[model samples]
Target: MTSQASLSVTAETQENTLTEVFSLQKSAFQITPYPSLTERKHTLQLLHRLLVNHQQNIIDAINNDFGLRSSDESRIAEIIPSLQAIHYTLKRLPRWMKPKRRHVSWQLQPASCKILYQPLGVAGIMVPWNYPLFLAVSPLVAALSAGNRAMVKMSEYTPHTAELFKQLITDNFPEDLISVITGNADIAIQFSQLPFDHLLFTGSTQTGKKVMQAAANNLTPVTLELGGKSPTIIAPDYPINEAAKRICFGKSLNAGQTCVAPDYILLPENQLNLFIDAFTAHFQQMYPDFAHNSSYSHIINDRQFQRLQQGLVDAQQKGAKIINVSDFAPDATTRRFPIHLVTHTNESMLICQEEIFGPILPLITYSTIEQAISFVNQQPRPLALYLFSHEQDLHDKVLVNTHSGGVCLNETLLHVAVDDLPFGGVGPSGMGHYHGQEGFQTFSQAKSILKKGRINSTQFIYPPYKNKAINWLYKLLLR
Candidate 1:
């Protein structure tokens, strides 16, 4: 029989390590309590420096993890936005930290009221494999800005990137101030179970449910950035070529591994062929030869690739047409899977039911804008909804009728890049906003404080049978 004693020891050791780290972070946070504005700015500046100085290393690690993550994609999607977020937060942190005064009612004479943004002690972040850098540090940036210590649990699927991130973070800051934890699913569960002040998780909806359950044991507030089938609708009036170009650009970037990437496109019934032609032309122009193109990214790992392959097979077997954009066969060895357009899909097909995280785009045709809107409403509210329309009335109508985390009018995948806008999801997609001012607010506690000096006004209403002053005061207040 195996040694149960050894197993027990191993389990105890892991538990000790997790507790030690949590305790250390908690103690460190108590020591400082609230970090000054200068300290917060310095932390942000250091993070900015870390990203800038190690840009090449980050690109290389992500490429090694993905086999061929586009360097430009990493720079544009990861580095630029991170730096921009830091800068934007730094510029606005002062105002965000300032207390706002409130009006005092006549009933509460000589009292002053204000709201203070205070730091929540410690935070825990669970990062997903896709877009590892941005997802991990974006929340970390917010936590640090709000003057809280954080511990990040990186995804195991991207080992190379996670290990490199661990090294970079360790070298940059103290473990108690900010630490990176790397392990398998068991560790993720334990990490989520920790009684942090707040927990933010970025991953799939199923995993998010488990994490939320674990957090519930501690009553820890959670911010879930989960994934859903984000739909893109091309209005009839919009030019098919422009729509196709932007859609293909958004979909093909990072092999459509992005959380907010267009999952399925709602096409106009009459211009389906023209839209396909234009989409193909734009993809070809962007990468004339995908099999040999280094600019395009591969699926992160074999398991994800197989899931995508199985989903495609399921779609094809259900009489859905699959249009492979490239001429090359998908080789498991290379892992550079090409984009496929699926049409004639029903809810029975796996592609329509689940989130297609890979480079699979299903084109659902609609007869009218109302049909498109209805189709979207029928499903769970998505993280993002893209509408390519020039008509002002249509935009107004669609905006009013639909509910999503965010909307992009005549664009795709670029709204998240805007630092001023709040980025998050709704319903099954996600909960909680984290970007710009919203992000700072997410990690901070808005403590309402009221002040009164030498005023015993409440004494007038003290325990008495029927005091004349109390009756007059009550009548005056009521009046």
Candidate 2:
């Protein structure tokens, strides 16, 4: 067959798979519109146990996909958090499921009002390649916690992990309750086009627009967790050494392959050397040898490695000073690239223009706090903002002056791990939220209900012409 014919065949198969699975989930949801709290808890329990039982398999699969994904990173960043999300949902679901009562006005004295949280039937989740397991399972926990059936579309970039997840989910879940679909961009397009009640996607900003556009065709509500150049602000008063330590920790995880990772830094103009020295020192202390260190993860694949390499080249050709934090040279065999911090970079370079989804950190200096705040505000709002400061005045100023999906004071990347925090983005960064109680609400609909008993109060004003008593009652109520 010709290449065109092959493409057509592939498209048709994906269409069929998406339709069949979505219909199955919708039918199942119809059968149990509002799942009992106990049923939801049981589902969460099974998921938690599945991770606990097959933890090693999950770690190995991710490592195989990444070529050198840290086993401890997988267990810490993926498995442990996934387990905690399930447990947190299980503990809070009872209260989340309860109908919230509202006070009814005296005019409607005989009626009772409340908001009943109802599942939005089937939910569609689009998982990203970075931290595949956590992104996939975190939203699943929310969907299940709110009593909805789910269909997840796993990224093709992580084929090994995707296949392993497919098998594990198939073994534990009924097809109608939850299903996993895997494919390239074409398959992801079809998955997004499906008529799900709600769609949640975690990926890049450019692709996020396409997903949102596709979802609009079906009028499906969506939650987008997209990436941007998240900025880190280091105040002059805060200890520069401590700030560098935290920033290095955040950026080194998965080689800065995280959505909420610090993409760049805004340092006080006088303290640039201090930050650079402290940052390099902290990174070296953390990983003594970069060339052979198993603790540091390699770039996910050749394409990503090339992207980072090209980005660094562009920064250098534009006259930006690139500082390699390690003594080891690039290793083609391992695909491990050393973390490079760029100074004197401008907006013309690709590193400054786009989200650096790798281990490249750009340092921009600011003379005043207002200038720092303005720099962050001028760009697309980020998924997270990191401010290293101890003063309440600076904290209040930054909080009120700028906007981001979430904020962390004197820390980095830990905000997302907090079970009580709502994780998401604002403006170009992304939209909607998940995690915590907000996640539960995202997958469920709050349906307002007003119940009235047999009462003749409304009959008093039903006449064609208002009488004296009716007029008096109306006046009294209006007063």
Candidate 3:
């Protein structure tokens, strides 16, 4: 067979496999549409044990994919969070599964209303390359906790991690219960076209739009966790050293590849030099020699590295001054790009226009607080917004004036770790939420049900409305 014919046959086989697995999951869900609370807890426990048993393997697989993913970073960001989510869900699963009593209106006095959190049958999760394990496991926790079967699509960029994860899941869980799909973009497109009861995707805004369009054909509801230029504002009253330390930690973690990492900073123009010095000092303290530092993570792959390099080149050509606080030279072979603080940037520059998912932070100075707020408001809504301020009024002002998926006051990125908080995006950043209680709801349907006992108060107006009693009832209801 020719090369093209061989490739076509392989694609056809993969598509058939996806369809078969989806059909199996759908049929399995039909058999046990509502899994018992004990069953759900057992599922979560199995997942927790899987992560615990293969902690080292997970770390090594991610490192192999990234060329130099930090072991500690993987443990801290991926394994720990996955375990915490499971534990949290296990503790609250019983309550979430119980029927919730709802108040009935006066007109419906004979009826009792309640909401049943029913499983969505099957959930489709699309994991991004940046945080492959965490992104995949987090949504899977929600799906299982809500008593739904799930199929996760892992990114091709992290092939090693994806394959390892798929192998691990296959060994521990039944294929029809929880399956992981691995392939390139073509496979991802096919996966998105599946008629899942609910779909949750985490990636870029452009890709999210396409996923949503594909899901629309099946009329599937989606919860998109897309990324945007999340901004940080440092108030004059806040301590510059404290603000710098927190922001640096957030940006340096995962080498600033986080969806909620502070993309840019807004500070008083006069304090720019002071803030820069403090930020530099703190960053150096975090990663003393970044090029050889094992704690510092490299960009995921060549494509991401090249994209970030091009953004830097475009910024410099457009009159932006790029300052490397650590002064570490980037090694393309290793793909270890240092944190760059960009200044004198304009809207035309790619650094200002795009989501800087790497370790590059742009400093946009403003004379007044209003100017800082206005600048953030003018841009597309972000996934996360950070404000460094001690004043209550200032915090309230920014919180009320701005729009984002989540807000961090006097800190950054830690909000996502809170097990009870919902994490997601808004506007161009993305849509819907999935974490803690909100996550359970997103994956389950809040089915409303009204019950009527032998006593039926609604009978008074059930027949033809020609009598005085019916007229009296209508007047009472309208009143």
Instruction: Please provide, for model 2 over 1-479, each residue's C-alpha lDDT reduced to its tens digit, 9 standing for 90 to 100.
Output: 69999999879988998999999999999999999988999899999998999999999999998999999899899999999998888888899999999999987788899999999999999999999999999999999999999999999999999999999999999999999999998899999999999999999999999999999999999999998999999988899999999999999999999999999999999999998999999989998877778889989889899888899989899999999999976566788877899999999999999999989999999999889999999999999999999999999999999999999999999999999999999998899999969999999999999998888677767886468868888789787
Q: Between candidates 2 and 3, name the one with more favorable TM-score.
A: 3
Candidate 1 lDDT tens digits, 1-479: 36988876766787678889999999999999999999999989999999999999999999999998999999989888888999999999999999989999977778999999899998999999989999888899899999999999999998998999999999999989898999888788878989999999999999999999999999999999997999999999999999999999999999999988999999899988898888888888898777889899999999999999999999999999998888866779978888898889999999999999989999999999999999999999999999999999999999999999999999988999988898899999999989888889999999999898897786777887399988888777777
Which parts of model 2 have CA positions greater than 4 angstroms off?
461-465, 473-479
The CA lDDT at 467 in model 3 is: 78
The clash numbers for all candidates, in the given order, read 0, 0, 0
| Candidate with the greatest TM-score versus the true structure | 3
lDDT of 2 at 303: 89
| Worst lDDT 10-window in candidate 2 | 456-465
RMSD of each: 1.6, 1.5, 1.0
Candidates' C-alpha lDDT:
0.91, 0.93, 0.93
| RMSD (Cα, Å) of model 1 | 1.6
lDDT value, residue 371 of candidate 1 = 98
lDDT for 345 in candidate 1 is 94
Write the candidate numbers in order of decreasing lDDT.
3, 2, 1
lDDT of 3: 0.93
